[model samples]
Target: MNGTICQSINQSINQSINQSINQSINQSINQSINQSINQSLSLLQVMEQV
Candidate 1:
């Protein structure tokens, strides 16, 4: 009855929260990886020029 409805709503909220957290974490990891790779490439180009 009312208890079941409340439980359902809570579950939905928790799911959305979990999804948002996962997405942010994934984006952060990807950005760091891209930055590191770009840095290494730039370093290599500089070394070549020298």
Candidate 2:
């Protein structure tokens, strides 16, 4: 019984840690994609102007 309790606690802690890591990674990936899209759009606009 005691061992099961410890395992459950460990699982929850691991889950939370994984969730936070995933969130940060997702945020960074999204930011980079947005930046890339914006840069591409700007470049296209400038090319058109030329």
What digit string (tens of lDDT, one per residue) describes model 1 on residues 1-50? 99999999999999999999999999999999999999999999999999
User: lDDT tens digits, residues 1-50, model 2?
Assistant: 99999999999999999999999999999999999999999999999999
TM-score of every candidate? 0.80, 0.93
lDDT of each candidate versus the true structure: 1.00, 1.00
> For model 2, where is the 10-residue window of minimal lDDT?
1-10
